[model samples]
Target chain A: MMRAVILAAPSVDALDNPALSALLGLIVITLIMTLGVMFATWYERKAVARMQQRLGPMRVGPWGLLQPIADTLKLVSKEGVRPASADRIAWDLSLAAIFVPAFLVLVAIPFTADWFVSPMDLSLLYILAVGGLSFIGFLLAGWGSDNKYALLGGMRAAAQLISYEIPMILSMLAVVMVVGSADVYRIILYQDVVPLIVWQPLAFIIFLTATIAELERQPFDIPTGESEVAGGVFIEYSGIRWSLFQLTGYVNMYAYSLLGAFVFLGGWEWPFGTDIGWGYQLLLTMVKMALFIVFFLWVRTSFPRLRVDQLMSYAWKVLLPFALAQIFLNGLVLVYDLPDVVLLATSGGGALALCWLVYSVVRVKPRQPLRMVGNVPATAPGSVSG
Target chain B: MPFEALLENYLAVFLATIVGTILVATALIGTRILAPYSKDRAKVTSYECGMVPIGRTRAQIHVRYYLFAILFLIFDVEAIFLFPWAVNVAQASHSAFWAMVLFIGILAAGLGYAWRKGVLQWNR
Candidate 1:
């Protein structure tokens, strides 16, 4: 019975024709990802709201489960007002520029043991390369909007995204170095005895930090900070167009979460040792991915947005050096045929050093309390104080 | 056959791109059909928190952004070069490892120079 399901799974050659299989696999994964992102928005709101001791989205459905659907309906019916000053073509085309790459990254992601839309030799590299293309969309939105806020936001988004991309790629490169394969499945298979995170804890930590920054969640969400450039590159987009930007954001979040799960958490091959069918493999993938998403939401709720200067410095000065160091360490071990235990020691020490560096920088002197000046008179007479 | 397999892999991505284009087009058309449109001058005016817009939108941005872009290009290209080397490191000879270290060291020196020049400083 299990053999039948495994045989029927959507691997590279599930159907008679490869084209047909590709089409069918894309549709299934697309639908699942869309629903997953929808559920994610509702979950993020509820989770973050609960963290702040507030009940969120109580109305749309049971526990506001249908809120994302309602949001889609509302956004779909809202007017897409283009600014008269905007570049009409680029403004409209930027949506496709951003949204398509988010979906393209899903092409190589394996949800189960044999259920990927495409299995490439360098699927890991493909995902990263495709994922980087969305920065162009942000830049286009900023340039085309003809709004000051949007322009400011767009440049910020591009800078932040590109700055974070280096460390993220390098961290993944460290993993690839260890496994000696950039293929996602092979990387997972190598983790049969122990997950890569145990061997490369520094890379794991750097990847997590960089992923948060890449996803533009709080602390790193300087581009879209409500207190600053309004909605940033999305300041001019309204209605379905605006909602598409938001949808891309959530989709990217899910993509990164899934990537992190497969890369560091041993994907479905850990503990269970890859003998289980696709059903359990899929379950393991979802559980690990959910852990990543929840951590993102928790960080989003708990952290304050970093200053723009601090954000850039953190990427260049802090994360980049550590990431390069991770690569060097991995190379050292692999070159000399060193024992795996050496990796745990060197990387674990590197992780500790990274933590210390961040902690030392973050531990600044507290600001003095505000000293209010006494005015001639209070605006409200009874509310006046000395 | 191997080449065909490679094309099949990319075929999935191509199909996804087509689907995405169709999805965006459908959303645009669906909004045109379902959403309301009113011709108000105020609505079309470039949004600036309900105030009369003062200057052109594409004014001079900070020069720092340009510097960062150039830096990003250098590092990004370096990273691309590292990927294939990284995957092949285990099978390669010890000399291969030293070669990478030299390559990275030179780049790191460049980075150090940039750092000293205050290129990484945002506010300064």
Candidate 2:
């Protein structure tokens, strides 16, 4: 079935040609990303449940296998609500605006060496540009609701996303400079002898950190921190609209994982060998992506959210400089023809510098509690007590 | 496939975006039709934990976000220039490498200036 579609897709007429294949690919990927979310939700619940010593969703199907499906049905059947003061057009437009960009991200992602939608020359740039657009929907949703908290949430999310994007791009820039291509496949191919992770551990760490922030995962998820400003930009959405946001979040998580795997983890090629067939490479890439996803989940459930102010400072103060320095180091290596050992040493030195930089920037004097115990009137009715 | 066939691949992306949007719209509109919507005055108003809402959303947004937009534009354009240069690196001379170094040095200096000015502090 798949073979026929791939081979026959080009023979069709111009309008029908790409559209047919696109339609088929979209449906397949949509289903895959949807299923990825479902499995991830179950995996998260089961993992966290076990870690916390509790059974999670045991009654729904065998071992809670059907829970995501059940949740989807419930969401589909639930009434969709709109805020009274909401801007109707933006409220509706926000759903597509957020999700379409996320879906477009899949366009540039390499599922396998052979299987991918668009292997464009600027695929890397394409992904980043489209990924950046997702937050705008949140901004619109926040504003459209005419809710104060929503606006705050939206702005906070905007600031976090925009700040983090610099480090993320800069980290990718390091790899792009070393490999000498912005093409995803070309980058992956450059890792045949040794993965980029082994080549540039510091960039790997920076990229992962920035990616977590980009996805708004825990330790960086203050935008939707329930303890503070309610659900933030997504507060007003309900029913299917809310589900789209949820779906976008999960899809983005998987997409970034795939990107990390491709760029740093040797992509489809295994670390041990480069002669592996497409099948093995595909499996290897998926395994790497899965490992990344699991790591993200662990970090997410384990960490507490950072203050919004701290998040901004971390991006600008720590990550941005580290990224810039890494770029300089990588450029120097390229110009001077440095050996792998030197690059490795540079990675080590870069890591130490990053740690020191963060420590210095985040250090602060401990706060003392208010000296005055319970509220006593400054001037007691008739006489003032000093 | 020919190299020219490469450009056609993006058509798939454009189509996929439309399909994905339709899929979301299907779920949203599906629920909108299948599920009952209650549009009572109180139900439709913004959520505030059973209390009345105060103030407007417009006045609350600070100018820092606008700064973020400008900063993002600068960096995005920088990345855009880096892409083509990175792609053509193999064909370029040692001079090409120095030229890029100059470009990125200026970019970093600009970011450093912004940091020194405390333009990146979000909450302040």
TM-score of each: 0.93, 0.89
Show model 2 residue runs off by greater than 4 Å: A1-16, A272-275, A359-386, B1-6
Question: What is the C-alpha lDDT profile of model 1 across B9-92, one tens digit per residue?
Answer: 798888899998999899999999999999888998887789768978898989999988888899899989999999999999
Write one digit per residue (lDDT tens) for candidate 2, span A243-336.
8888889899989999999999988865755567778877898899998888887887777788877787788777877887887777667677
Cα RMSD to the true fold for all candidates: 6.0, 5.7
Instruction: Indicate which candidate wins on lDDT.
Output: 1
Q: After TM-score superposition, what is the CA distance of residue A96 in candidate 2 from its true location, in Å?
A: 0.5
Candidate 1 Cα outliers beyond 4 Å, as residue runs:
A1-14, A364-386
Per-residue alpha-carbon lDDT of candidate 1 for residues A80-160, written as tens digits (9 for 90 to 100): 999888898889899999999999999889888878888888899999999989989998999999999999999999999
DockQ of 2: 0.63
lDDT accuracy of residue A102 in candidate 2: 91
